[model samples]
Target: MKILTIQQIIKNIENEVVFEAYAEDESFKIKIDEYIPYVCAAIHDGGQMRDDVLEKCSLSTYERWYEEDPHTAEFVGNFPILIQGCDSRFEYDLNRDPDNAIYEEAWGKNVWETPLSESQKQRSLAKHHAFYEVVEALIQKLESKFKKCVVYDIHSYNWKRWDRPVPVFNIGAELVDHQKFGDYVESWRDGLSLIELGDIHNYTAVNDVFYGRGYLLGFITNKFKDTLVLATEVSKIYCDELTGESFPEVINQIKEGFKTAILNHAFEFIKNETSYKVSKQVNILHNELESDLIKIDKQLYSLVKDFELLSVINPINLEFEKKKFLASNYKYEPQFKYNPLNIDPFEFKRKLSNIKVEKINDISIQNMYVDTINAYFDKVDLLANLGTNKFLYNSLRYFGEPSKKDVDNANFVLYCPEFRMEKEGEFNENEVVELFKNATQDYGFQFDIEVSDHIASKALVINSKKKVVIKKGVKFDKRFTKGLIEHEIGVHMVTTMNALKQPLKIFSIGLPVNTLTQEGLAILSEYYSDSINHDRLRELGLRVLAVNMLTSGKSFNETFLTLMEEYKMAPENAFYLTTRVYRGGGFTKDALYLKGLKTILNYIDQGKKLDNLLIGKTSVEYVDTIDELVDRKMINSPQYFTKIFKKHLEKPEINPILQYIFNGIKD
Candidate 1:
């Protein structure tokens, strides 16, 4: 427990003696003895939040510790190389990517009063990078010294939170090539399962609650071929979780038991036949390619966003650019390098045709990632191109649009005029915000409600800092209250907040091609809550029809008349729906509302899980990609869900007869 710098720790490890050193502010600590071939790490064991960050957090200290794996380092204290984090994961999760190490929400409670500014996030990310720099140096030294090494990446989990009984031990092998290290992983689990202290039945299993798909394990596996790192989580059977107290006997039993188990696995690893070591150059190339794709994604999203800004700056200029750009075949300067996969030319063309899904080694996962990201990039490009052109954008969006036949098969449409809710009474914007606040409060999400004059379209929208913004003159239509709650808070904001907790900035900022899925899922939430109304369904249908008109070269005025004269919508509602379709000189994304609704209904008809829809700012189409990342342990299932769904489902009388019936408004 010596207070020292990373430089000092790296320098002293060669001494072949037990010593410990603390990296900056004592937030992360490491110890080494002689030149051991194995290291132990407790990357998520910390519960300390910086004073600056703590002042802004909504969570109590007890809540943070409950999620943090306590006493992870102590289990392997005797190991020669031991590294563990001391700062609370709420401050920065060492196991996540540095890009999204800081969280906007943790377990659904707003983790910060406001999202940290660039400087504040930079401080935390800088610290994260420093910790990894030391790790890179440490592993490099070990592999150089031992020619091959093993690392026991230690962690813990709360078994009580799980609905079903899980084994006492979980081994994550999602990232590791099992064919190469499967024997060692299995042997470790078998040895630990048999550990006996006072109670003798501590069970162990592999790939239970956690798969060794954490960033630390992934980074080590990718960077160092000779090093086999094991990501392990022990259920909180060794302590009092509510109080973060360890039972002395249980702790000692684990320390002694895992010590034996780890050493045995290490020895076995050294002599294991059929090494699956990949070249260092390949590792470097994969990392570089991944970074480049992310960089391009960031550039594309950041530069192309702000539809409001574009429309406001100079509508005249925008119109001019739109017309001029259309004359040039509606092509604007490319936002990023056009090599969608960011791979070499030949491989890039090949990937477009051959989409493979496998995870045999780093290579297989790398190929899968390439394909996934490329698909996302195309979606993103479509989204970006939407507002820039009416004719061209409509042409592409029309492909995703549901035809009349597909619309006929819509499973749920709020079409019964008999239950018109306008006479039921409406609430003002303040009351609507109050309802939102009450729902979020029940779920432990803390955020502020403010009247905003700056927003363009949202009657209300949740900002990045978790603040709910209401437009100045917005009123809550009685018909829309329940639907808006489930759509925005349950789907949109839930995904936004959950994405902040993930390691990928793409999830927090925006997912590749996620708009359709997000909107579709929001519609699902509205349907599930039984808040769907004829007016809302008609509005959605008109948006699709409006976009169709645009694709067919109809002017904005013509689309507006179709909704008002043909659909008989009121002037105001027609204005909002039509304007949404024509906002950015003929934006076509509104088509997704109708298209996505059909997609989700089809998804439900096929008996697919809906909870995964809440996993970050994700699309239902990218469900497989999300699954791979989860199986790889890159992300977790959404921590917060609309509990209202459970409550709504409990009503036996509310049997929804599956049929979409929309009585067309008379001309």
Candidate 2:
């Protein structure tokens, strides 16, 4: 490949820049080589206005920037043979016909305060003429080497101004001979539609937002009979148009993703192109199965919600010693006596395994969908066995305990004790209700809260159902309100609302492996709200140690003694910690808070986007998989976002003291 200078880059361009031949101009950066059979050009990317026009133009630099293609260069960056204009379109728009190159009025407003003199007009037209001269040379070079050549004329549009969801990409073919290349064009759109940028889906269409009627496409098609130009218009969904800043990741994703797909389609076109189709029924079936899964979630969680607290707290005011002994001796059995499993896991698994994955666009992805659903059903079976020895055995099978790394990470908690001044105050339930109502309004979330005797915890949170049942007679502390809202509503309820925006029910309920991520995100939300206090951290630390003891087969008395004596926790608080782990057949779920906090904090430090975590019960483990679903438009972005943690900021360094407190396990 060679880079050439514009003066030196006439029709028969040649350059002697070492590794190859080339003359170069900033206005035109073309990577040309031995008959590559195609060229990718972005003609509207320039925004430099000539000094002469500076006095004559009425628009501001930003105004012209708003109309310019900011990242078209990134989209076509990787092509071996490329041609892109570098001058501002305000100087001359190569895509427009020669006479219209310098706009008299652009879009709707007057572009210039005064019309350009003949010399200035000729100057702009001369550059336009020079661009086509090289384009024709490049085309001729390709046509002589191969029988035909194809051009991908790339540009972007402002889609947000439109009233509806438009295609992420639009291929304009008005100027192309669709009679010969229509199938190839549609195939290209289909493949582009499958391209993804993180969790954002790529929706592509043909002749939708723009028909390929640009002068560049017309000139090439009319002059070169065998040459085809696909006028591709991608919406600036890949960037914040208002800010004039582009997402490099998205730019890279498309630049790399489409490079090969475009080449593959072209090669196929060169060899009798065929068409591909996607099944509409598979999407319907996915929706139907999701409905079935939603029913299973209600049954599973309702029974297990307060099982840990209720079963462990003896109603009778027993002696302190007796309570301590009973805490360890707490025995549980199958709970089908009250809450029966509505959907049998075994049958549910059978149904999911029977799905015809081959019908989906990507079979492996479809299989993952099945596996994730089956995982939820597995949890349902485990929930059915809650309070029994059977539940403990099954809990091990589904939700495993924190590993050594998880324990080790918990010790590094952030030490901002002085920052927790709000913890000193107290408030009543009415205050709590008002506070929650105010917090919800920040994100525009809708829900109801009430005080109730049937509730166990001070705040019995049922976020997925948008309900927070406050235990009657318990005075609510004002300090707990914000953090609790951040935890329960910001993280949990916000995700529930976000899930509703998605097409699948799994997001609405939970991803089966969601326990760790869900709790972790909840705790993280508390921290983001600045409501995290040492007391809350200590409570989480105690739960971690308690769960570790249970998983290691320590009796409740052993765990209780460790919390009370070694950790110096009060007797009542120690009992609460013991039961939290030993309930639900040795539930190891509580350990996740510290584990989740550390993991999520590390993820942010490593520069990962956290929005993926908010998309309806998504686990950090399945982010890539969930992203693929989101890219397919099978899921939607979070509709409800947390104001507390609007976006992840730079993470503070891990606190070794806090880390030691949580992740430490004495052998």
Best by lDDT: 2
* Candidates' C-alpha lDDT: 0.64, 0.65
lDDT of 1 by residue, 439-550 (tens): 7787677677776544434444444556676655666676578888788787777877777666555565455446677888887677766677666776676677777786
- Tens digits of per-residue lDDT, candidate 2, 401-427, equal 867765554443423233344546777
Which predicted model would earn the best TM-score? 2
RMSD of 1: 22.0
Report RMSD (Å) for each prediction in the order shown.
Answer: 22.0, 22.1
